[model samples]
Target chain A: MIQWAADVSMLVIGVSLLLSLWRVLIGPSVPDRMAALDAATANVIAGIVVFAIRDDTLDYIDSALVIALLSFVGTVAVAKFLAKGVIIERDSD
Target chain B: MSEILTSLLILTGAFFLLVGTLGLLRFPDVYNRLHSVGKASTLGVVSTLLASVVYFWAQQSTLSVKQLAIVVFLYMSSPVGTHMMARAAHLIGIPLAKETQRDDLKKRRGSVPANE
Candidate 1:
């Protein structure tokens, strides 16, 4: 039963990843692409979780944690750059 | 019993993830896409992570701290990332959808200069 569930969930995650990839490709603006990329990152994490459960191993959980951290950092950096035109602003104060 | 619960949670998470990606693809504006992906994907991922915790605990009788840490980290970061993206888009003067009736931020801030 768990195996079947993992397979089905993997299929769903695959479809969602493709959809997110489509958005990333054709997004009209920077934020659109960023949002799609962010969603895709989350989908990847979900996939990793399902894989871990299916294999009955705790090894992949570390990778999931790392990916989540990196994606968040990437998103924030890109957003900051988009808004301010620079990642690190000089303190005027 | 635990297998049944795990399967149900995984299916539920997958459903939400599909819905979120669908919204990301179809939404007309960046803000709309952010709104959809931000909330839906976070919930979806969280649910799946919870399922992993449940699975590990049921099968091995050992609690998984990594999954719980991921859940906490995601809950904290997803919203912040979404907010930053939306603000950045706004600051760069990305136009809204035709259906958007009001932008209180624009009204109050009175025109954020496009930085780029």
Candidate 2:
């Protein structure tokens, strides 16, 4: 059945998410950890799609978009901080 | 006609998502894994959204377009975000893998030695 297959696949995605969480926890450096977070977001996106399909609702899609956007901003801000030690600093010369 | 197309699109999208998950689990390096998840999963999610847009188009045209718009924004943003993060990581002096060679930035900056 299609439902069964999608469910199994969702489980696989969840497993991958656990792996990403592992990296987020054990990553030796900041970028590594942030990369893991990004991966987690991607997994969440997939999970959202799967949930939408299963529940037959479009609302989940909206949440997915929100998560995707927030994760983008969060990951970029964190990465910038790691790289330059500051996200943004206004001129005060 | 629409069912078949939607079915194919969803299948392909699922396949790509599966591959992205595999890459996330299997890849050793952070940057490499990002490449795996970023490119592969972006394509997968976008394709799936497009499929949903198509499916809902048959049922109710307006809603799917909203989903498509979300997909468009996501597609545009994901890559730029990933690349920025990767380059940021490099700039922050996160060491590359041991097998990596010929880092021109390192050479230009005189950070890495000549033999390396």
Candidate 3:
């Protein structure tokens, strides 16, 4: 049952990743691309988790956590740059 | 029994993840897309992680702390990231969909200079 579920979920997640890729390819605006990318990141993490289930190992969870942290930072940095044109602004106060 | 529950959770999570991506593909604007991605994907990922926790606990007779940590971290971070991206998009004047009824931020911020 776990094997079957993992297979199905991995397939579903792969399709999702493809869909998000399509959105990224033709997204009309910057945030549209960013949103797609964010969704893709989530999909990737889901894939990794499902992989862990399939392999019956705890190894992938750490990598998923790392991906999550890195993607969050990247999203924030890009969003800040898009909004204010700088990731780390000099004192604005 | 535990396998049944884990499988159910995995299917549920996958369904949600697919829905979130479909929304991202079909939504007419950035804000709408962000709305879809933020809520649905987070739920999807968390559900999948929970499934892992269940599977490990049932199989190994030990809790999966890392999976639980990921779940908690996701809950905290997904929204903040989404909000930051939405605010950035708005500030930079990513145009709203034609069907948008109102923009309260515009009223409050008093005419952001269009940068996009």
Candidate 4:
């Protein structure tokens, strides 16, 4: 019975991932797209961890961590750039 | 013990993720969508990660700590990142939905901003 839940969860996660992708594709503005992309990244992270646990692997978890770090920086960079036209600014000006 | 617990956790996590994604797609504005995807999904991942920790620890493996750590890290970071991104968006003057009746940010002076 519990295994049934595992399978069902996998299906739901898959669908959720798909929905996020859809949002990413159809988002009307840059910020909307950015938000969708961020959400997608989070979805992928969750999916990876769950699947890795199901398969009993530590490798995926490590990569998931890396992805988490990279995605956060990337989103921040893009959003900052879009907002202020710069990612890093020196106060020496 | 591990199987049932892990499966239950994964299932619950997946449910939140599904709703978050749905909210992402259907929400009228970017900030609202962030509430769904960023907040809900972050919680969802933590639950799933806890499931993994339980599964590993049940097998007498000492590696459950690693899973717990990752879960905790994700939980801490996801919302902060999302908030930063959303705040950036709001500052940049991203358009809100037409139906939005109140915009407290607009009423504030010196509110950091411009995305568009």
Compute each candidate's TM-score over C-alphas.
0.96, 0.84, 0.96, 0.89
Q: Judging by TM-score, tell me the better candidate of 2 and 3.
A: 3
Residue lDDT tens for model 3, A56-82: 989999999999999899999999999
RMSD in Å for all candidates: 1.7, 3.9, 2.1, 2.4
lDDT of 1 by residue, A1-93 (tens): 999999999999999999999999999999999999999999999999999999999999999999999999999999999988789887793
By summed lDDT, the worst window of 10 consecutive residues in model 1 chain B runs over B107-116
Interface RMSD of each: 0.9, 3.5, 1.3, 1.9
Stretches of model 3 off by over 4 angstroms after superposition = B111-116
The TM-score obtained by model 1 is 0.96
Q: Which candidate's DockQ is highest?
A: 1
Per-residue alpha-carbon lDDT of model 2 for B1-116, expressed as tens digits? 86666666666776777687577667777677779878887787777677667666765555565677778788888888888888787776777777776677766758664223
Q: Which ten residues in a row have the lowest lDDT in candidate 2 chain B?
A: B107-116
True contacts kept of each: 0.92, 0.37, 0.83, 0.69
Over B6-113, each residue of candidate 1 has an lDDT whose tens digit, in order, gives: 999999999999999999988889999999989999999999999999999999999999999999999999999999999999888899999999998788676644
Question: Which model scores highest in lDDT?
Answer: 1
Better of 1 and 4 by DockQ: 1
lDDT of 3 by residue, B1-116 (tens): 99999999999999999999999988888999999999999899999999999999998888989999898899999999999999999898889999999999888787645443
Indicate the TM-score of model 4.
0.89
Candidate 3 or 2, higher lDDT: 3
Clashing residue pairs found in predicted model 2? none
Candidate 1 structure lDDT: 0.94
